[model samples]
Target chain A: MATDAPRRGAAIGWYVLLSALSLIVLFPVWMTIARALSDGSATLFARTPSVLPYSPIQWDAFSRAFTEGGLGRPLLVSGLVTLIIVAAQTATAVGAAYAFAFLEFPFKRIVMVLCAATLLLPIEVTLIANIQTLQEVGLVSPSQGFGEAIGALTLPFLAQAFGIFLIRQGFLGIPKDLRDAAQLDGYSDLGFLRRVAVPVTRPVIGSFVLIAFLSAYNQYVWPRFSVKTNRWDTVQLALRRFGLDNPDQLNLGFAAAIIAALPVLVLLLVFQKQLIRGLTAGAVK
Target chain B: MGKRRNVRQWALAYALLLPSLVVFAVFAYLPLYRLVHFSLYQQSSRLGGGERYVGFGAVWDVLSGERFLQGTWITIKFLIFTVPAGIALGVLLAMAAHRRLKGIKIFQTIFSSTVASSVAVSSVVFLTLVNEQIGLLRNVSWLSLKSPNSALFAAALSSVWQNLGLTFVIVLAALQTVPEELLEAAHLDGYGAVRRFFRVVVPLISPALFFLAIVLVVYGFQAYAQIELITGGGPLRSTETLLYRITKLQKNTDLQVGASMSLGLFGLTFLVALVQFRLLERRVTYGN
Candidate 1:
């Protein structure tokens, strides 16, 4: 009973700490939502916003943000590009991880070492020469449309060392006995991978999918440089223009910011369980 | 039969690996190889002609210049603020939520959400919050910090907030692995909260703390978005980091110098990472 009392007290203290952190995490989100609903009649920065839409909320801010900011085209572009990049990053990472975990080949150790060694180099350093290369390939020319622009934005992040490293760590957690048994039973490599390996590791795959999607969705600078046209801008580019153009319309900018972040937040909520497992899984190895 | 099976396995391995190899070759290795080549050549915009290979002159010019030196100093200053402050906040948050408290899962979710909010999003939110004219702090007179200084502080705040979730998750995971029996024994010995944490909890978690610190330092040097959004490296380039300066060189007036600067930044990042891994490896205790 004495031990139980201490545990209960400790639990209560933890509740207080959690409540305070929740407030800190939720304030910016609260401010964004409040500004979104307010129609510029409300004071956003004030301690007590009296004129905030108290009864019938304004939905017009959403439509105005969409139409005036030209966010639709960028949203579509970012979505499609994000989809493709995530698929590519996941496929490549999975394949490389399979090689690293299951196969023993000539120079296998060398390849793995090289992959680990390159993690420190940020992909930004290679942009200039790459832009020139894209221009040479005619992808950056004026004649090409949104398709080419999206490709240019997605091209650089297609294969990442970090992803390869992560998936390889997951792949290593699988027991080798299963692989050996499958091989002895006359199951081919691809068949065993499809039938056994992938099913067992679905949670890790889901986590990687979410992470890759988030990275692609939030990409800004690459799109800013490579797209070079407002017509082909992604969500981030559109919001940046909103901030720059209507510097006085803080409410509108805030509304647009909320809109841009909503999809990622929904995605996070859906995959929170898998994400936690995946992130902690890496540290375990 | 065994030899035949081994050959098939090797063939499958190579086939599975091809696409990743192709992508990395084009994106990472090819560009790295090309960056070295571009650093030597000069662009002639006036004549609309191709670059002439001018050898190591670009590298020499960049190293000898004062602007690059100033940019390096600023980047180091930014790192000084970001690395220690970011990791400490992460540890504090992690420790606070490490128990089975009510709504603990909800708190964890909120903390980790910032991991997905890119540097651009974080920077934009803070920029609006602290704007000189329309920011939240605009009307307060006791906020004696200058506008530019306030902007830098705001930038640091955004970075720390965004990093809080990542640091907390890592440290909390480490904290959870501490044996409960040992803590119970300490409590039986009449150890107070402060003494117990310092004497027992800290040493076991030191390795995670060390690892988090190294990552924060590397990321601090590579910061670009906050600098771009909040300060634009403005009010006399007070907030510019090395990566941001390299980007400005690439986007603004010059290209060749920018290429050289990028290579320089890459080298610096590489050196720092090496030093961190070497120094910090001594402190990290693997479960083995």
Candidate 2:
């Protein structure tokens, strides 16, 4: 690590410059938190509220955002959807990656190509068709409680190509001799996967989960077209609704945005490296 | 015995792979097939006009029309506004944080904090900042209602802010990999900090920079939520990018038009990716 050691005299200048940049970057978040806590939703727009919470920290707005603003349900929905997405993606990706890495099957090359090709046609490119498929499967207009929730939110993203690719690379990078040795030691294929492959590639799988979970949680477009009713609103859609419905309720809106961002903030704090690695995997060699 | 063992291996591999293959087939491959198939039809089933086969005419209709050309221009303008600004700021932040000074970790955390904010969250934050009547900036002397371009700039401002964290983290990571001895060698050669950076540091980090450029361009094309949220694709539809137009068509129930527009957007995305791979990828200096 080339830690660019600071010179004694010039350190002050670097500190000042870096501080200014930090303030600039963190300003929006500060503003958001301030408005969220400001009294009466009093800090509408014109006046810049203190970055620190202003007088009478609007505990009401937080409760209102949770209750009146129809936020809690979406939080639950987002949680459920994200949980399923992460679990399903990780499991399927592990299985497929293992198959690709160690097993011989007919159409193996074609299956590999198919996996790679999914990268090119991101859901944005196939929006209408996916919606149509969703409708055909009766997901778009489901009648009821759990089925509708699962159908619209979790079904579309049960698998991810990126996860498969990331974990496949993980499996392949393990030396062939190790797998052969495992087999010679009387480990079945599934046994080898459980005892060796998974534990060794846990970091790669961990990063993939982080990426997939974040993407699922942050989904905006799909929820818009899929969840026709507020009963199934994801956090992203509900936040947009708050903005649209109460653009003037600046405090409440920022409060909701802050609330929505909290989990991600905690996650990023804990797994910053994993998130970065997951995000930049495609860009790096 | 060999035949039976091979059969068993194939069955096990396929059984393990079935769930993922099925999901991809349904969600990824099936939709793509439909995208092409429905794009050929003359009219959407929604409109209740008797189906007339168009044989790609609908696609031609969407792409040839003025709507899509203007959309392309808006998307490109957004790219121009954000990409270079994002790169410049990213590099500056990366350099500033790369120092080994005391308490630098706090600065690095602040720089990367926006990565936690999703597109919708950031858009909401900016909507308040840029609101026309009660906006924080509304009373600023120069930026009144008459300022036509301010909203677009505001949208871009939010985008640039959100991008800061991603770019900073990536560039900073890349910067760490630049060999220290190389910088020392350049210093011994009497190259100033700026010259050393341009001659050696920049070349080494070009791969990271190139990656940012491609991702930013793709993001520019696909941008929607911010426009839809803050601007609603207007003060005058000025902020509507290519994806916005496609989404608008979808919303309005113009299925045929939306499908064609989707295809056009896909093509545009493909073309942009192809161009970057050809132009920038060739020049990228991957460090050993």
lDDT of each: 0.72, 0.79
Candidate 1 residues A76-177, lDDT tens each? 988889988999989888888888887877778888777676676566667666776787787775566877887888887887777877777777777889
Give the per-residue lDDT of model 1 (tens digit) for B99-129: 7666777887877777766677776666445
User: lDDT by residue for model 2 over A1-285, one digit each (tens)?
Assistant: 344555554898888888888777877777666667765345543255244666767767777888778789889989989899999999999999999998998999998998888877777778878877777667776453667756777776888788888999999999889998998999998999999999999889998989888889987877777776778888888886654335345567778888898898899899988988887776665
Kindly provide the TM-score of model 1 when superposed on the true structure, using C-alpha atoms: 0.90
For model 2 chain A, the run of ten residues with the poorest summed lDDT? A40-49
For each candidate, C-alpha RMSD in Å?
A: 3.2, 3.1
- The lDDT of model 2 is 0.79
* Candidates 1 onward: DockQ, in order: 0.50, 0.60
- Candidate 2 residue A69 C-alpha distance from true site, Å: 1.9
lDDT (10s digit) by residue, model 2, range B1-288: 999989998999999889988888888888877777767765534545555677776678778988888888888888888899999999999999997878988898888888888888888887546656445665554333324465566777778888888898889888888889999999999999899999999999999899899888877776777778777777677777878887666532466677787888888888988998899877788767
> How much of the true contact map at the interface does candidate 2 reproduce, as a fraction?
0.63
